[model samples]
Target: MNIPCPYCQHPITPGATTCPGCGTSLLREATPQSAEPTCGYHPRRLSLAICDRCGTFACAECLRLNSRQEVVCQRCHALEQDTPLPWDLREELGTFTAWWKTVVAVMFHPDTFPTFRPEGSAGESLLFAVLCAVPTSIVGGLSYMGFLSFVPYLLSSGNPSRDSVPSWLGPAMFVAIMILGPLLSAAYTVIQAGLDHLVLKMGGVTRGFQVTLRANAFSQAPWLLGAVPCIGPYVAPVWGLVARVFAYRGLHRTSWGVALAGCLVTPLLSCCLCGGIYLSLIRTLGGFN
Candidate 1:
């Protein structure tokens, strides 16, 4: 979260007091007669940026980046100091270890989300989502490949070549599923997260999209259930929705109703549409028969 220099509109690093672009001091004093906006706390100092939390003008000396990477006034910053999630401490915890801790925490201890930092970079959130998605995709693909591998045995009934699935078909299907499963999962995660963010916005959430994205991604912790053989994929979707609702409520500081609606509405609509299409196709095929 880089701040733009008030003097030159050049991007400055967060917490930087001086602009490297123009070598200008961020804490310039306001002139007595000039008609420039002054800091809410110090009338003699020029305002550098408006506080994201309080919406008050603040001077460089009064402004600081909060735990969420938002530029806020000193008073607002002092009001909240959140602890970072394990995912945010990847360098210290090691990437895989941090991700595993975050998954467990999100899946079992979601109540702590309100106390953890709400903001993570968009890339970080997406990476978490992809990580969650990959395992489920791979497991589901493996299950399908296993079924395909057994198809010849079942269809052939002791005959190798007659009434059996093509020898190459199983491997072909395996290759296709292995390649497409993770890609589709990643796409679904992005699209569904975007839809959830829109619903959260409609529910009057003032937080940025990255916050919603982070919540949505972390909510997928339950997807780890895919490791369980037969029932994992079936159970993961319902559990994921439950986790999503909690994530939305805790991270966005919104009501349970808003969070539930945000997490459930898109999925429900999709189910209805698919169900309708399936019924129509069945009816058409029956008429042909």
Candidate 2:
């Protein structure tokens, strides 16, 4: 069994009084009791420690190290670790409400992200990404279809000679996109997560690809704001990138520099390469002229 040194989070050998890695003393005197009390969790065992927060009597088996490095009772530890986030309230609040609340929390209360238990698989993460992407993808697609279907007619309204796109084309395009767009977005999420995983690994994250994938998935929550008419296209991309940075920093338990480098480097490089290609194409076309 691997346990962490309370001071440095380095591995510690079991039953050791001092951390071999950090040389920090782990031995502590449990607050002495006048009379042996029954443990709160294990009634049969004599209490050896008292919870610093609640003053509950707990046996060795019922004691845990809390964030403050104080010995806490199992109940108190559970209270802190199991406080439900909005994401975990899906059944009670309904799917859309839960998702919206989660998005709001991620945007405004990012410190909560670190409290989120990272236990999901990559497929689960990608599915969440797909759901988040659907609203935006459909909204943007329909907006485009509307512009494509009606903008020409609006421009040519005064002229009777010009024709508008067939009425069937608009609904057809919208339907096709509503069906296919989410799938493509989910596929892209998988690819994007895999790419981000490489960068995160280089930055010293060892929690594996699923952690990165989940972070990437939750980051997509901001895109749901894209359903809010025209502003979404302009707003979601920038905010989503910011969210991803925080998500990585929290999920991987890494420094901000590592998180930012892992999250931004590949994307920035891709942008530079694409810009170069665009400039080269422009120069080639200019030469042809």
Candidate 3:
């Protein structure tokens, strides 16, 4: 009689103990020769295997694969999919730490992309990018404020009156930076993500715009690196670019080549276009002079 191994679902001879396919200990006892059990869902059909989750008899039609690759009923499968990823636990874990772990995981483990559903609002994604920009902006702003406050003192030649900066200017700059930094960052993030989505469409990405936004948002997690004094500004952009490539590939379910083209082409084109405009403007002004 044909018997399937519980571990790997490989067909094996009846009365076998250890599964040759997966080497898992088949602690399963043989089914008794008594009356055949009916499926929990369809009473007319005979049960082939028991649902590992609910302990109910399941026919082949009712069998579904769980996260552990074990056989489960359709209800269990639906429930499992309905459960949230760690990234969605901001309410329980606090906003910064939750997104932080998600970012770290995405940067380190691109293969786990399948576990994330890439389902969130573009507005939500923009807000996330804005929040991620906060620490970086604060660090940079504080540095700028420090320079403004101290430059006059250091350059005074022991006289504070010469080239003195207004006391209110330093605090004013800090307040302005704190207020406008996140707003500007969020605006730029949204615009750039929209542009990236257009490029992604050109690359045959079929996922909706929301998914694209999510990928873009999560990829900007490296922006947190800008909190560092010297290298933060330099490293964050490069790190973000690399992360975006993987994020696009995973979220769009597209090839690496497509993801690369989508993520890089729009930004490169925009840079070239802006550079050309700047050069043209410079030449025009030089001619006028």
Q: Best lDDT goes to which candidate?
A: 1
List RMSD in Å for every model shown. Answer: 5.0, 10.5, 11.5
- Candidate 1 lDDT, 1-289, residue by residue in tens: 6678977999876456789899898888998999988999988888888898889998877888876678888888876777788999999999899999999999889888877777778888878877887676666667677787788788677676754566677667767876676667667777888898898899999888888889988998888897677898799888888888888998888999999999988988899999999999999999999
Per-residue lDDT of candidate 2, residues 4-42 (tens digit): 665788875433556788887755333455365767766
Q: Which regions in candidate 2 have their CA more than 4 angstroms from the true location?
A: 1-85, 88-93, 148-164, 286-289
Clashing pairs in 2: none
Regions of model 3 farther than 4 Å from truth? 1-85, 155-164
Per-candidate TM vs. native? 0.73, 0.66, 0.69
Count of clashes in candidate 1: 0
lDDT of candidate 1?
Answer: 0.83
Top-down TM-score ranking: 1, 3, 2
- Model 3, 233-256: lDDT tens digits are 899899999889988887787899
- Candidate 3 structure, TM-score to reference: 0.69
The lDDT ranking, best first, is 1, 3, 2
